[model samples]
Target chain A: MSRVRLSFTPAPVHVRTARLVGVAVARRAGVAEELLDEVRLAIGEACARAVALHRQYGLTELVLVEMSDGPTYTVRVIDRAPIEAGLGLAALPPDELADEALTDEALTVGVGFALLAGFVEDLQVRPVDEGVGTEVRMAWPVGR
Target chain B: MDLSLTTRAIGEHTVLEVGGEVDVYTAPRLRERLVELIDGGARRIIVDLGRVDFLDSTGLGVLVGALKRLRPVNGSFGLICDKEPLLKIFRITALDQVFPIYATLEAAISADSSGSGSGE
Candidate 1:
């Protein structure tokens, strides 16, 4: 199995760079040509969300991305922002709560996940096991 | 890499041409430009995204915010995006039904001339 990992400062400017690197890695991993756009977009949204969370929480840690090529090409984006006890367990439906009442930053973050759901077919959002924050895991089929 | 925004007046409408990627990093610039136009008394606006290579949800949020800003004054807002990849993003988000999207700049401007901003 081949794996690639990227870590970058949590910043909006770095989100685009992460997307580019993720797509290049995906292409090298045999992700289909037609699906590259989706891969690129999903990576951007994931990285952007991580950046927003880090900024909102005033955390300066690096955002983490891990990509592995196997039966499926998997990408996992991790943010170091603190999460409420049960917030991560609920799969971040903050979309519904986003409608009731939310700060502008929260709404912006919420919309990113909504877009991720639309772009990634196989997706999972969960709390980190060892530390604070959320992990957005997405998988796409690959051809060897 | 960088976003390029330029505006030109065409008849009673203002066409803002956008080029390059529109993601979280670049979307703020887009939002700022839209605010400037609205504040500068631009009522009917069409964003030409024909040159845009990439657009993310943050960019869509900026466009949606612009529409909201223009609605109170009965201003018209439309987009010109002929590229299939960008159009697919709109379709995936169901925003294709929300925004006035045209295939060409001429079509958007002509639609404005007909007293309707409904795009193609």
Candidate 2:
């Protein structure tokens, strides 16, 4: 297995850079062309969410990305900003998860977990290190 | 990558040609341009995405926001996107139902000008 890690400031400009790096690493891992688009979008959204969270919480730490490549490509975007209260996926009731609740304004305002969930093969969002921040874990098969 | 937008007036319709990547880094610029056009009384707008190399959820959000902004004034917003990668994004998000997407700029402009647009 091959592993790569990248670190970036919580800035909008770095989101694109992180995405490019993820795509490059995925390409080298033999991820197919059609799957590259999904990789690109998923990583971009993950970085964008990280940046927005840092800005919202007035945090000053870097966003870290870890990638592992083998039969499956796995990416973990770690943000040093806590998930906002009541916004955690586990915190919301089942009824609130409906598509009607995701307004354009809401989606634009940093509620992109749904988009990430839709694009990746697997997704896990959880607090990291005694609730200091959030980690977004995403993975997809290499050939898919 | 940076985004470039150029505007042209086609009779009653306004066309905005977009080029380059439209991700989180560049989507804000597109959103601002669309807001400016809407604020300036542009009721019929066509966004040509033929030159756009990439688009993500952030870009889709801006397009949806623009469509919502036009709804209050009975404005129409249409997209010209033929590329499969871009079209696939819309399809994945089910946004193809929200915006009137055409395969070409001429088709979008003609349809909008003829009052047979889908944004209504």
Candidate 3:
């Protein structure tokens, strides 16, 4: 598997920083329009959640990573936060999800992961360092 | 995939018919449409999302921003959310209460309700 990696401290609400870096890295490997935006958004959304968790749960810095597996570009957001970090976003605060109309129970757990699954071609979330940090990985098909 | 946006005028209201997924990538385009309508001097805007296949936070943000933008100018804004999943997401987030929602665009257009504007 061919892969490339980059790391960042995850600045506060700095989506541009993440997208710029991710796209730059992915572009070198031939990522296109809709897929590019998909990756960009999924990366930012996952990282933003990680950032919130770090602030809410206590972590040093967030890590934005990307990998190329020949046919696809996969990005993994690494952060030290509780597993619920992904679950909480299922029912985002009204202010954050101001245009959505879902219920807390309907949201359930792992909803963010579900959204990530739907947006990204392939999605995976697993514990890093035995659950000390979470790694949210998403892959998009980018043919040669 | 390219998103499709259509506009229809009923009485004094303008309904923007949105189709396709409303996620991060498409949200920006929708925001552009909202601004275009406002710039074109269309005050009464009803974002008809009946055809919207998917709605995410990024998409929702554009609407919230639009709501804020329409308010300061004392413009009317409402939404038509027929999809149950979409409705559930909005309800969970309490956004349904924040934005005037109607079963159909005609119902929202009939309300003639204008929101207070303050853009972010």
Candidate 4:
């Protein structure tokens, strides 16, 4: 397996840097053109979300992106911004929350996890460093 | 990558041609331009994304915000994008139905001329 890693400050400008590096690495790994498009969008959203989270919490830790190539392509975006209790797990009643309300909230809440889930084959969100921060892990089959 | 925006008036509609990446960093620049155009009495706008290399949710959020801003005045907003990557994100977020997307700049401008520019 081949691996690539990048570290950058939790700044908006650096999000594009991470996305470019991720796409370059995926291209070098022989990822298909159709898949590369998805990969690029995925990385951009992940990095953008990380930057927004760090800015929201006033955290200074660097956002780290790690990519691995093998039978599958995997990428992990890590941030040090603390995940609040019951965050991203609330199950809102469809009757109570209007679609417009949800869309408005999504603007400030970072990239929608549902969107990411639709793009990648496998996606997992978990607290890292003893629940002090969050890690977004996503992977896709290499030949797909 | 950096973003560059150039604007021109197409009849009563304003066309903003964007080039380069529109991620979190460059989205604010686009947002500012959109705000300026709208606040400057631009009632109809067409954003040509043919030259845009990238767009994330941050960029989409800006577009959505612009749409909302124009709604109060019955203004119109449209997008010209044929790129699959950009289209995919719009589909994933169900925003494809929210904004009228066209294959070319001329089509987008004319779309509003037909009195079908009001956003859903």
lDDT of 4 by residue, A1-144 (tens): 999999998888787778889989888777887788778877877777788778877888899899999987889998887676213633233232224555644653433554576688787778875657788888877663
Q: What is the TM-score of chain A in candidate 3?
A: 0.71
TM-score of chain B of each: 0.96, 0.94, 0.89, 0.96
Candidate 4 residue lDDT tens string, B2-119: 7999999979989999999887788889999999999999989899999998777777778888888888889999999998877877776667777899999878877789887666
lDDT of each: 0.82, 0.80, 0.66, 0.78
What C-alpha lDDT, on a 0 to 100 scale, does residue B13 get in candidate 4?
A: 84
Cα lDDT of model 1 by residue, B29-99, tens digit: 99999999999999999999989989987887788778777877888999999899998877766667667
What is the C-alpha lDDT profile of model 2 across B1-120, one tens digit per residue? 479999999888899999999888888899999999999999999999999988876787788788778877998899999999888767655677667899988899888778778474
lDDT of 4 at A112: 50
Off by over 4 Å in 3: A1-127, A130-144, B113-120
- Top-scoring candidate (TM-score): 1
For residues A1-144, could you state the per-residue lDDT of candidate 3 as single tens digits? Answer: 667676666554354466667777777777776466556656656765666567666566656565666667778777777765544434345454432353322332234444465567677777775656778877777656
Where does candidate 3 chain A have its weakest 10-residue lDDT segment? A102-111
Model 1 lDDT on a 0 to 1 scale:
0.82
Which of the two, 1 or 2, has more DockQ?
Answer: 1
TM-score of chain A of each: 0.84, 0.81, 0.71, 0.81
